[model samples]
Structures are given as structure tokens and as C-alpha cells.
Target: MDALHAWAWRPDGPAPAMADGPLSGFVLGVKDVIDVAGMPTRCGSPLTAPDPAAADAPAVARLRAAGAVIAGKTRCTEWALNDPAPTISPFDADRTPGGSSAGSAVAVATGGCTATLDTQTAGDVVRPAAYNGVVGLKPTAGWATTAGGRAVAPSIDTLGVLARHVRDAAAVAAAIADGPALFAPPGRAAAPRIGVLRDPFTDRVGDAVRACLARAVRAFSAAGADVHDVSTGVDLAAVHAAHRVITFAECASLHRRRYRDHAERYGPRARELIERGLGTPARDLQEAGAVRRDAAERLGSLLEGLDALLVPAVPEPAPPRATTGDSRLQIPWTLCGLPSLALPAGTAGPLPLGVQLVAARNAEPELIAAAAWCERVLGS
Candidate 1:
């Protein structure tokens, strides 16, 4: 019943609103890593000073222009990395709510906000939505401007949304995207060509998640979707390895000076990542970029005839508060910079399970439509 920890700060009265548009009544929680004019962006780390920002991040500005009420700044993991936030899952207080967009997901799931602006370098947005039983949408890299936000991995870090419904998530995305039609809900496809990915990444999910995926597949088939089992054919392991190297290197690059001067201020996980990045050879970083580009091409090709690729959002339901759930299932899509959507599919006892849908780059409309259809079919 106590979820105050989810918010880093809240206004004494209603937060200011902008001219009315599609999101006139929407209440949005901005992640701590993103700037909100007049509010301090702490990024849930002691490394940052609590200085009020002069302007809003593009994502926040766009949402505000669309008439969304800025609820407050939600908590995030330190620098949106390995460290977990203090937020607790509404489903079970003893379990983790996922991270580093932990507070964003928790706010949406608990009805504290209509939607939230979040950032995802790996599985931060979708993983947390899955764990908290909400809807998450990560658009193509560069689709939503990351200006005015802290970068975890500039090359891969992306702005995203978490909402109680797929349509709400789509609305938020459409507002900030370069193309107004990016996530505008389109007419439902008569038969969505859904490709269910079967790879080492998916093979690692636990029984509950496996069963949840199976149930989703059945629902899609029953709803007249043309579902087929498929593979990306790219070396997933190599892609994941590349993701880590790139993320760490970029993060370290961003924090090099601060870390060098005050290493004691960082959490253990963040410190370890920076150290790894500091030690990584330039040749290794370049090779990782090559691997990433090659995998992106192969994965994009795999979506040639498919409306969306499906997979479990996480390996299992939210675990104990000690750590966030695994991000293996989401890393490949994120690395490829493809658009993905996560929807609550079922439950494991008291916790929730989710399925992710991915589409080719710049295919946010298709991805949103497909997710909406699945959301309907699953009755989530």
C-alpha cells in the first residue's frame, strides 16, 4: 500500500499543464534522469547535484505540449545502470519492481500516473513494465529525442514510455516521435504475421514465462493471427556481448572524469561497469560495434515479411528485491535499435508475466498495432 518511494519528488499542488491536445488529461511521471524545468534531476545518484534544470527534455516538452500534467520526477537506478531503485512492485512489496526505470513502471501499475517518460538502454523500460504488469513501448533508437537526459549508452540509449494500456503508451510515443503517425493507432490487421522468436535467448526463460508465452501464442492463433516460429539467424550471444561492451564503454566515457576524481560515490555495480569500460581495449570496442551493425542488419532482414517478432519480456517473474530480473530477452532488440512493445500477458501466482513484440526499425505504427491486437486477444 506504500509506494511513496517510487517518487523522488512531487509538487505541492498539481503540476503545470500546457495547451490541450491528445493527452489533455494525462498525468505523466518523468524519470529522474530526464530534466523537467525548475526541478532537480538527481538521476538517483549522489554524483549529481540537486540543481533545478532550466528547461525540459524534448520528450517531456513534447508530452507537455500535448497537454500532459507533469506529475513529478520518478526514481531511477543510479545513472540508469545496474544499481536497483528503492521502488517496490505493487503486486508484491517483497519483490523487485525492475529497473532502472523502476519508479516509472511502478507509478503506472499503481495508478499513480497515466503514463511515464522512461529511458531504455537495455531492458530498463520493458522489463520493469513486465515485472509490474503494465504496458511498455520502446521506439526505434533516435525516434524520440534524448536531448536533456543523462545518457547511459549514447549509442543505444533510447527514450520510451510505460502506461497502463497499449493505446496510452502509443499516444505518448506519438506525441514525441518525429513522425506523428509513428504510433497513431491504425486499423487492425486482418491477420497479423507474428514471428515467435526461438533462440538461445528465449530458451533461458523459466517455466512460468515459457508457459505465458505459449498461452500468448495460442491466443494469437485463436484470434486469427498468422503465427509462425522463426529465428533471427544472427549470433545472439555475440550481439549480447557487444551490447555489454558498448554500454559499459559509453557509460564510462560519460563519467570518466567524475569517477576518476570520486570513485567512492558510485555504487558497486556502477563502479564495476566503469572499471570494465576503463580497461576495455579500443580494438575490442570497435569490434563490438562491427558485431552490432552486422546483427542489426540480420535481425532487420528477419522482419522482412513479419509484422512483429514475439518473445518473453523477462526470463521469469520479478524476483526478490536483491536484483532486477534478467534482460537477455530484450538486449538483442535494443542493440538492433528496433521498436518493441511489452504487454502483461498472464500471472505466476501473485506476480505478472509479459510478452514482448518487436518490429523492424521505423516501424512503430506496425509494432503498436500488433501489440494492441495482442493486448485485446490476451484481455490484459
Candidate 2:
């Protein structure tokens, strides 16, 4: 924050003075999960209090090297869980801004910052971006490592970005991904083959969301893309169950002694989640891991010959300030560790709605290419 404050505080920064050279010269909001050397990483918890970090997360380092200014840490769900923060909606302060990447999305949406870093275990990145009508891209798992910061569900956790447009998202993603996927491509054919998931995945999404999805499909099809719905026969209920087991187990291990020994200091939701994780039987956790591995493999098989799997990123739009929006719409894909992007489709009353673009595991470059093309066609 000092750097951002310094920039905002003095005439040396771009906001106060013109840039001396060519660069994007944009300001960026870094998610709390990512370390920006010398900045405190509260991760939205009272106990895990703020302290300066020793190094800039690789993502931050690259952006700075490219001349982007760090805009300070944004509010997040405590420990990146369901606990809500004080960041009220910019659209309607009475509503939730969505979390755990809440502030990052709002920062971009409200034009307080040009871009922001975000992370997702389940829906942290996409849901918030959807709620705020911005673009969020979660590249393939492991494409960007979580080396310098906290981890809630390491297996599914990914470093993502929130920006106003697909091009900005792509540029930032390139700066942070496994080197830009060798040459970026525009969309494929006249009819970009998109598979809309059937059954379990689509069934859970709410009515308004379904309507928005249909609009998105029509937009793409009208733009010359083949938008078709298909069923992969993947049992998402089973996938969700397995996901909960693995994520909680991993979260529990991360918070093990802190949860038990420093019980009072932990946030209510995170504390309870950790306790529950400890109680889960070892056999159940083992079974969950096995299930997840099988699911990731099967997901690839199911996505064969497809460009992207289109679905709702969240079940509904942002809910009341009482809690964050739903995470179910994202849980299963996270379990499979596939890349997903949440693009704002339209509005649901005062809140924003989103669509997800899923691709086979590790095929992020292609997924992003398709998304950029979709954004162009939809004019999103």
C-alpha cells in the first residue's frame, strides 16, 4: 500500500505526472493472496494479522518489471472462505461485492484501479468479477504457481486476473502465465465449436442465469459461432462431493495447529471448516483424492474435440450483503483443475451475471484465445 500510497501521495507516480516512456502505465490491484514485497498479507483474518512480505509474488514482479504500479491489497473473505467482508457493492452498497477477491473486482469496475490480481479455490475470482461486470480469467492450474503467498486449497488454487476487457486480461495473463502459450491465436473457425454442458452442471444454475446463458449463446451464434448444448455424462454431484472433501482436507492441513491451538483467533467459518476437515476420516480424504484425480482425467476425455465448455460461473447474480454469491457453479471444475474464465454476460437487476468458459486441462492458451474472440463477437 505504501507504494500505491506513495504514487498517489507524491508527484513521482504516473497518476500525478506523465510517464517518461512507452508502457501500459496502468495501475493494478493485487489480491491479498499474492505477495507484493513489503506489503502486508492479511488474507482477511484478524488473527493472521498484517505483516510485510519478503518478496513480490512472481506475478507482481513481472508486472512491475513491465511498469505497472501495484494498487494495494483488496478485501477478501477471511482466509478466502465464505466469511463476508466490509466491502459493500459499488452498484448497491446494500449488497455483497462478492469474495474472496471482492475488492479486486470492485476496484476495476469502479475504475479505482485498472486491473487486479485474483485467486480462486472454487469461485473467488470468477464470481466476484461476474458480480462486478468485469472479465476474470483463471488460467490452467499450475500455469502460475502459488510460491509467495497463502494457500487455502492448493490443489485447485490458481492465480487469476481481473480486468475491464479480454485484451487486458490476456495481456496480464501473458505476463503471469507459463510464458504466453507460444503464439496467441484469434478464434478458430467461422463457427467456433462451443459445448454447453447439460445435466448436473446446467441444472443447478438459476433461471435468470439460464436466460443470460441463452443470450450469450445467441450472441456468439449470431456472431458466426456454433453454439450447441451437449451432455458429457459427467456426474457433477459426485464431483462436488469429492471436491468438498479434498479442498477441506487440504485447507485443514494448511490451518492444522493454528485452528486447534489458536482457535479463538480464527474467523468463524474458516475455524469451523478446519475443525470439520480434521474430523473427516482418513479413508474419506483418500477416496476424495482418488475421485478428484479420476475426475480431472475424465474431464479431459469428455472435452475431447471441443474448443470450450460453456456454463454459468455462478448459480445467480450477487445476493444481498448478507453473504457472498454461490460457489457451486464453480466447485466441480476447480476439482478437475481445468482452466475457466468468467465473462460478464449481462445484468440481473442491479447485480451483474456471468458465463464460464471451461477447457480441457492445461489447454488454457486455446481457451483464452476462444474467450478473446467471444468477447469481440459479443462486444462484451
Candidate 3:
């Protein structure tokens, strides 16, 4: 009945009110993709066999060590793909909250928890946070360990952070990073050089979203950021195709046995994706990897003199709840394995809008710094 309160776990006992620690007193919602001891990881699908994990995921273990409460497993799209979860957004009942990390975003946005762990293969983390008016941080592909989490694509599936504030996101990130120095506060730094990405992706956005982004750029300029347009110069269509091939092929491989035996249990969308993956030739996957490498190089060149790249977190505000919303905006960065931070910029009509900041691999600190700056100046 409680959409925000998806479930609860007290693995070590009730969350304590510890006075000191990176995440002391923080209640975190873990996406169903991540394993939490004593909880059955349903992964937002009735098809999941609901296995109780033997141990906490590495990220979960790190957070628990840092004094964060293992709040519960949040809902996700079935197997972290096109299948929709049963959760609804607190902002508007009619519109989708975004997925496959929908419940995690909704929990943070609604204040049901202080923060939440999300996962992104495409826009699962960034798009949903944008739609729900929260901050979502997808660190570099391998920054946080995914040992005990369900995988969509082993190569790209990343554990991410979603919260109401950039600082909260950073704190959780640091805890999970297993490296305390990744998010050390950047003190009184000069304005960062920001790159604005535009193309067919920008063209697909609606008027309100365009205005929201324009205003955000203006705000950054007023705050002394060096902003400019930068082109990735890669064939985006091919890049997207590459991403799909990697994700679908890997997903099918991971579930090949289960899907073969219990095909009827899968939702329609999951079935479609898996079936496509099953039919894909190995040569296509190899070619997709080549495309991914090429795009990564081009993307690196685009960021040569920039601190971060700016883009709409999604094409528009949250759409009707029937769908999870478009993922086109966040796919490029995800494919490139760059760290991206999505911060609520403003609103378009009744729903929230977000802008994303992307940085090079292991450049999470820069991403966090720019996001914090935007949060302070833009007042989201």
C-alpha cells in the first residue's frame, strides 16, 4: 500500500543515531538489484525466484560499516530493463517515476528515506532522479563493486547513488567507493569549465525542458562558469546500437538457463529483450564493443578542456505512468562509462526537470563539485 516504503530491513538492528561517521543516521533504500542479507531480491519481477542472499553486496557492506541503515530493497524494472515496476511517483500519480530504479528514486524524492542506492545500465538512475526531482550519481563503470547485485550488462551495469542533495549523494558514494578520498570536498574552487551537449538529442526535448536548460546555463554563466558547446563527433545511432547489443546479449547470456526453463514467467518486455538477445550473433556483439571503444575515445576528446559536460537528464518531464520515459539523454554517457550527476534544475509544468553533469572516468570528484555548485546556485 505504501509506494514509498517499498520494504524494510534491519540486518544489524534498528538504525542507530550514531554521532559520527560518513553516513551516520542515514536511512538508505537499496534497489532490488543489490543483495541485502535476509531479504529476497525480487528485482521487481514475479519471475525472480526470490532467493535470500547469503551476504550483503560489497556496496551494501561498505555502507553498513559506515553506519547506514539497510532500509529495504526498492522496486526496479523487471531485470533492470524495459519492464515497468509497480511503484508510483509521489509528485504525480499519473506519471511514471522513471526506471528501472523507480522505487529508489521515488523513496528519496518523497523523503521516505534519506537516500537510496540505484543502478544504471542506461538511464535507470539519472532519468528517474530527474523525473522525481532528486539527485542521482552514476559513478564510473567500475568505481563501486557490483559483486552481489543482479546484472543487466556486466560490462556497464553500475551501482549508483540517489538522494535529495548532492552532498548526501557524495557521502553515500564515498562510503560505497571503498576509497574515502574519492569525494573529498573541493573547497572554494574556481568556477569549472562546462560543456553543453546538443544535437538530435537536444532537438527531441520539449520547449519547457529547453527553457529549463537555457536558464540553468545562464545561471552557471552568472556564477562564473566557463560554458561552451562541444561535439562528441561519434555516430550516435551506431553507439546506441552498440549499447543495446552489449546489454541485450549479456542479459540473455546471464539468464539463458532460467529463461529457457521458465519462459512464461517473464513480463512481455523482458521476454522481448531476452529473445532479441538470444537471436543476436556473437559477431554483432564484437562489433558493438568496437563501436563502444570508438565512442569512448571521441567522448574523451570532447572533454579535453572541460570540467564536465552538461545535458538534459531526460528529454522532458516525467510522462504518463504507463511508461518509464525516454532514456536517450543519458545513454551516451552511460555507454562511454563516464561518471554523471543528475541534479534537479527546475520544473516543466507540474513535473520536475533535471540537468546532468558528466565527467571523465575516475573524475567523480569533479562531477560532484560541479553538481554541488549547481545545487547551491540553482537552489534545486
The number of the candidate with the highest lDDT is 1
Candidate lDDT scores, in order, read: 0.89, 0.77, 0.84
Candidate 3, residue 330: CA error in Å? 0.9
**Using alpha carbons, what is the TM-score of model 1?**
0.97
**Root-mean-square deviation of every model:** 1.4, 3.4, 1.8
Candidate 1 clashing pairs, residues 3+ apart or interchain: none
* lDDT per residue (tens digit) for residues 1-380 in model 3: 37453443334566556545778889998998888888888777777665688888888888888888777788888888887778887888888988898888888887888999888999999999999999999999888778988889999988898999988888888887767688764555668889998777455788888898999999999999998887777777788778888888999999999999999999888899999999999899999999999889888777766788998888878988778899887887898898998999999777999998999888877777888887888988
Candidate 3 backbone collisions, by pair: 96-321
Best by TM-score: 1
- The regions of model 1 sitting more than 4 angstroms off are 1-4, 14-19
For model 2, the superposed segments whose C-alpha errors exceed 4 Å read 1-23, 182-191
Q: Estimate each model's TM-score.
A: 0.97, 0.91, 0.95
Q: Residue 51 in model 3: shift from native, Å?
A: 4.6
User: Model 1: how far is 237 from its true place, Å?
Assistant: 0.9
Off by over 4 Å in 3: 1-5, 8-20
Scanning candidate 1 in windows of ten residues, the lowest lDDT window is: 10-19
- Local error of candidate 1 at residue 40 (angstroms): 0.2
